[model samples]
Target: MNILLAVLTSAIAVGGTLIGSWSTYLFQRRTAERAEAVNREERLRQERLAAFSTYAAAVTELKRGLITLWFRRRRALRDQDTREELQAAQLDSDRLGAAAEAAAFRLRLVADDPGLRPLMTAISTHLGAISHAADRQAVIAIEARFEEAVTAFIDAAAARVQ
Candidate 1:
């Protein structure tokens, strides 16, 4: 009878140890999964932030280039030397436009907010209008709208990333 009692006690202890170990393993696995999820979210936020900022900078540069090209082309009509300057400005404008387009594509890929796409496109359309603006007043008007579109995009992006 004593030997049987001893065997039963040992079996109970072994069973208890197994239960404890299993519980601990489950807890640790859950914690690790939570941590991994948080890390993934942070990484996505960072990528979105980088892509948005890059796109904004690229578009702003393109806007400036377009305005400069517009003014230079106007001057070229009156001055011979300005024609050479106009060509250089045209080249610069083309490069900036390409960079802005590439940045737009990157932004589109990373952007979670659906509203941002139209704002991005609006800025592009604004820049195009500026390139063909009939007068300084027209360019100035488009510039204001361009700024508004950019600001809207930024606000939407900020809300999304947070």
Candidate 2:
């Protein structure tokens, strides 16, 4: 009888120990998973903010270019300052496009929204047209299109920003 009681007690103790170990393991796993999930969310938020900064910088440059080009389009000798601004804007646009176009530019930004490309292309085309215009009408066309494209891009980017 004593032998039977001893074996039964030992068996119960071993079973309890196993249950305790399993519970502890599950608890630790859950905690780790929660921490990992929080980290991921934080990383994503930072990435978005970075991307926003890049896009905002690019848009500001683009607006400056548009202003310069528009104001100088009718001038007999294109303003040297405006020309410089155009060049700077172009460089900023390229840099932003590289990132807005991909993942690397964001403070850690992501997403591949292709709709933004057309606005950039339009701005470039219109700006280029101004340089090659043979007459006032041609210049006007460039002015109109450039403004339109810039406005559209700004609107879109603003929407995305908010």
Evaluated with lDDT, which candidate comes out highest? 1
The Cα local distance difference test for each model comes to 0.90, 0.62
- Which digits, one per residue and each the tens of the lDDT, describe model 1 over residues 1-162? 999999999999999999999999999999999999999999989999999999999999999999999898788776744566888999999999899989888887877467787888798889989977899999999999999999998898888888
Worst 10 residues of 1 by lDDT: 75-84
- Alpha-carbon RMSD to native, per candidate: 1.7, 6.2
| Tens-place lDDT digits, model 2, residues 29-113 | 9999999999998776566556655654554455455444544554425554566665665566556446443432442236345
**Per-model TM-score on C-alpha atoms:** 0.90, 0.50
Q: For every model in order, what is the number of clashing pairs?
A: 0, 1
